[model samples]
Target: MKFLRTALGSAAVSHPAIDLQTSFTAAAQAAGLIKAGQQFDPFANENNFLLGAFIFEDVGVTAYKGAAPLITNKTYLEAAAGILAVEAYHAGTIRSALFTKGLATPANAISKARDSLDGPTDLDQSISRDGSMVNVTPTDANGIAFSRSPGQVLNVVYLTPKKATKGGFFPAGVNGDVKTSAGR
Candidate 1:
């Protein structure tokens, strides 16, 4: 918490945090995904949602990277391509923002904090500094943005590389097929 405040700066944390439970409930209701009396685990769902974003983005990219033929439907392949393009744009936007905010300082601090929680791994590379030198954006051998596999993502969420059913971001486990680390 203190690290978050320091990394994000005092002004960013000045206001009280939003009520995540209420917000999630309202969002579910608005989406017509939940009934008035239906029960839902907002905390787990929220964590799942956050983790799912990265998963979806990586999957979208992977779909276009020689896996396009796996999709029997041409329309679905096109949709996957579209999703990949959008995710790339979104990644660029985030990277640009981080660069503007001084990637070598605060962004690196936040990345270090995340790495500490997630455990050291190539997938959890720091925004600035690959080793002893500074690094802005991580790229593959061909200079393309790096992508993480589902297992790598689960490793981060579970806070360990070992197989896990639940822990870290998902204490009670995520919902559906992707609930456990083994599911990856």
Candidate 2:
């Protein structure tokens, strides 16, 4: 079979192995950002509601993109592509909350230091579980050209924090910035 997937982060190609996906989801829930049977309704109060969600979702999208090239199965590759879309949609929803007037995003309340991607240890910086880098292809204001590396993509997005400038968008943790159906 001819694999038409030539992109570094495409469904026909890049997709994290199932185990990684499960592990990541568990980590997210452990962070208490996700609740069982609860919708993604970010807090509109001057708290870091959307901010927390943004960090989770944005990191997730990039994580998949960073891990995509490492997968060798087409079926899993397609799933990753679908999941990435869902992650993006989640980000958008959180961003929209930022526009709710008087609302404060996590980035707004939490100090940049607390939100930093340095992880739990000051000994080193990490992009993935294995100390690898995160590569991400960031499209511009409009969908167009982009470039990414797994290490650069994920780490860079979370290493720094940013505030949003407009509505219907949440700042990507790294410059930070994903969708789907089936609760994907």
> Model 1, clash count?
1
Top-lDDT candidate index: 1
* C-alpha positional error of residue 129 in candidate 2 after TM-score superposition, expressed in Å: 31
**TM-score versus the correct structure, for each prediction:** 0.46, 0.39
- Model 2's TM-score against the true structure: 0.39
Q: How do the residues 1-184 of candidate 1 rate in per-residue lDDT, one tens digit apiece? A: 4543444343332433333444344334333445687643444743334322332333334325434455576655666566667766654445444555443343443344334333345444444464335443456778865554444455545544466765545555444344444322
Q: What lDDT does model 1 reach?
A: 0.45
Q: What are the C-alpha RMSDs, in order, of all predicted structures?
A: 15.5, 14.6
Q: Which stretch of 10 consecutive residues in model 2 shows the poorest summed lDDT? A: 175-184
